[model samples]
Target: GIQVEQSPPDLILQEGANSTLRCNFSDSVNNLQWFHQNPWGQLINLFYIPSGTKQNGRLSATTVATERYSLLYISSSQTTDSGVYFCAVTPMDSNYQLIWGAGTKLIIKP
Candidate 1:
């Protein structure tokens, strides 16, 4: 079983600021996804990168399986970005079970 951990358990930022969130795993992973839980509790998939870097608009993510860690970056943050960011991973030995981190709570102020 793999253990997932997200850093900076909580974060607060003003609009237009940039922030970085991190996730660390205790073992190798074959599938990794980043998700956002909005204020209404709807979960949105942000990234599905198991390795390497990928970007979408003002958001980007990088995962290094060898190092057992991943990072999510948010640039020019907005109030809409206020939510809980989660890191979910499927270990190399597992097929469908996803281990999820406690999540990083982000609050963006106007």
Candidate 2:
């Protein structure tokens, strides 16, 4: 089983600001994903980086399997970015179910 934990349980930012979110795991994992849960409750997959760095517009993520942690970076924040960010993982063993973090709530105020 893999345990997931996210730092800065909550965040508040102004437009154009930058922020970083972190995720730590208790065990080695074969699959990892980052998602943004919108106010409407839709989950948008931001990254599927099992062990690498990826960028998409104002968002980027990096995962280090050796250290058992991952990071999600949000640059030039905006009101549209307000939502809950979640880190989920599936262990190397196929028998385990996906483990999800408590989620980090982000708010970008005007």
Candidate 3:
């Protein structure tokens, strides 16, 4: 079995601030992803990094598989960024099953 943990279970920031979210896992993973649950409850895929780093606009993510952890970075935060950010992974021992983190709740002030 594998376990996923997200740090800073809750976060509050001004609209233009920058923040970093962290995800740690207990075992090796075959697939790792980041998602943002919008206010409307729609899940938006942010990254799918089993290893290495990736960036998209004001967002970036890095997964160090060897160390069993991942990081998500957000720059110049916006009100639209408010929601729940989740980290999900499929362990090396499982197929078609994703273990989800409790999620980090983010609030961006206007």
Q: Score every model by TM-score.
A: 0.98, 0.96, 0.98
Which candidate, 2 or 3, would have the higher TM-score against the true structure? 3
- lDDT (10s digit) by residue, model 2, range 16-84: 999999999999999899999999999999999999899999999999999999999999999999999
What ranking of all candidate models by lDDT puts the best one first?
3, 1, 2
User: Among these predicted structures, which one has the highest lDDT?
Assistant: 3
Residue 3 lDDT in candidate 3: 87
By TM-score, the better pick of 1 and 2 is 1
TM-score of 3: 0.98
lDDT of predicted model 2: 0.95
Residue 20 in candidate 1, Cα distance off native in Å: 0.4
Q: Which stretches of candidate 1 lie over 4 Å from their true place?
A: none
- Displacement of residue 12 (Cα, Å) in model 2 is 0.6
Task: For residues 57-85, write the lDDT of model 3, one tens digit per residue.
Answer: 99999999999999999999999999999
Q: What is the C-alpha RMSD of each candidate to the true structure, in Å?
A: 0.5, 1.1, 0.6
Mind giving the per-residue lDDT tens digits that candidate 1 earns over 6-86? 999999999999999999999988999999999999999999999999999999999998999999999999999999999
